[model samples]
Target: IFCSQYMSWTRNYGVQGTIFPAPNFNPVADAQMLAGALQGFGCDKDTLVAVLTQRSTAQRLTIAEAYQSVLGRDLIGDLREKLSDHFKDVMVGLMYPPPSYDAHELWHAMKGAGTEENCLIDILASRTNGEIFQMREAYYLQYGSNLQEDIYSETSGHFRDTLMNLVQGTREEGYTDPAMAAQDAMVLWEACQQKTGEHKTMLQMILCNKSYQQLWLVFQEFQNISGQDIVDAINECYDGYFQELLVAIVLCVRDKPAYFAYRLYSAIHDFGFHNKTVIRILIARSEIDLMTIRKRYKERYGKSLFHDIKNFASGHYEKALLAICAGDAEDY
Candidate 1:
């Protein structure tokens, strides 16, 4: 949805990205500074956080290349040696291109004893068709496993079916038809009302097949006829990961940045950090729309994400998140 219309969408909405190509960015110079930060006894955590967090992913990759050329050492390897825990995770996550990072997260999410269903949902449900394709390609290249096959083995039932549909990355893009929206809305309302196991695939088909633009129209048409939000209906009709996956898709379609804002809020609101979720959202969206997510975070939660991070997180981890956050919405 976002990929196909990205050019037009950014033009219409204006990009609210937090990070960009650093001005006067000399990769060799930046690499030298990073080497200096990493070389000494204890490593300079402050310099590492400041330099890495502020640059775009593209810029960071260039710096990494320069680091290898200048010092004959791998930047990511050096970071792994020096940094530890969640702080190290965040720094390492920042170095990869977006597709590789997403692939890495997805691989780990499904790698161990149990699948991190939320990680799968967070990534697959929210990505555009092109993004999904890249991730699938990366997953194969890096892990030598098919993403869809891995997902199929890891999950089951209606939830598995839904993920399978999404993994195909075949959603219709851009164009919308209001007439179809009205028809699909009725179809969805009836399916929800039935709540029969029979209608599960039907629900998945409509939600997964339509363009995001068309789906938004369907949702509005749904509200007009049913007098309840589509999410509420899905909640009423479904249970478990199936319901959660559907809800994530709907929210992402409605407002991608706002959906991510809710994710950041949920991650930190539980008194301690859900470090993986927190790190994923901030790093993934840093170049795309973290600024707008910050704006929505304030609008939805009534406090700045930065403020919440400071309250729930401490030390270098907090600093890296804040640096990605750029600053509080209130400051702007």
Candidate 2:
């Protein structure tokens, strides 16, 4: 149900991020400004949003350190106490180191009653091997639990198996074999064609272990062999979270920024407004490919992410998200 059009823009994004290090940045000055903003009667929500959202994540961490050293106050803690609602959520998400943030989100997703399978699939499928490694380590350090084990416990059947395979983070990187792509595509087609028993293991092995580049090739080969898009085949073959995760991987392999752009659009329109999903994507991708995401959103949806967000959200929450988005559609 998602667009699979791989754009030329996805191939080359050398710093296509909306957020960047502020020119002439001074962490101490930013920390002090934040301190003053939060000092008096009530809090200066505007200054808090301005300083935190404008800075890069690394710069925000530095400001946090400075806030702790110079003022003996934790920046995140102060912000949490001062800000409220989704605005606070965005500010707090910014303060975390990326892996920590991912780990935190993962833990949050799986913690309570029903698990957030989409959140799990989103992070695990999109991250690189190194990023997955760091997130695993952070998950252990922060929560004192194995991420794979928790996910395995939370999920079951082939879905659990596929997630476990991705958790290994051993997908080949920067390498693709044309011959193997053809072979894997045949394997996938046969597995899908099988009518009896569970071919889920075979499908998961190929889908989860292949490098994204190789998977892209496999997808092309699959099309040539089966005369059907792999995504359509999966939709026809599989069901539930397993199918969703596999499609997500394909989408990311095809075009990560576009996958996230679709995700952003879904978050806005799917329910009333999925603030957590919106906050997570905006904060996580701000320094990665949000600019590309913005462009793709406009191309695919015929409107700017900023414009949709402005209409979906209000008050400080909207202001903070808008800042991270940098500007409207025309800015890109």
lDDT of 2: 0.87
Candidate 2: where is the Cα deviation over 4 Å? 1-13, 195-198, 327-332
* Model 2 TM-score relative to the real fold: 0.93
Window of ten residues with lowest summed lDDT in model 2: 1-10
Give the Cα lDDT of each candidate: 0.89, 0.87
lDDT of 1 by residue, 1-332 (tens): 33335434653687776766666678998999899998867888999998998777888999999999978999999999989999999999999899999999999999977999989999998999999999999999999999999999999998999999999999999979999999999989998998766688888988888999999899999999999999999999888999999999999999999998888888788636799999999999887888889989999999988888888889999989889888323363
**RMSD list, candidates in order:** 3.7, 5.3
Off by over 4 Å in 1: 1-13, 327-332
- 1-332: candidate 2 lDDT, tens digit per residue: 11111112333545467776666788999999999999966988899888988887778989999999999988888888887888889989999988999999999999977898889988988998999999999999999999988988899977888889999999988789999999999989987899334567888888888888899899999999999999999899888998899899899999999999998999899967999899998988987888889989999999888889989999989988988988323452
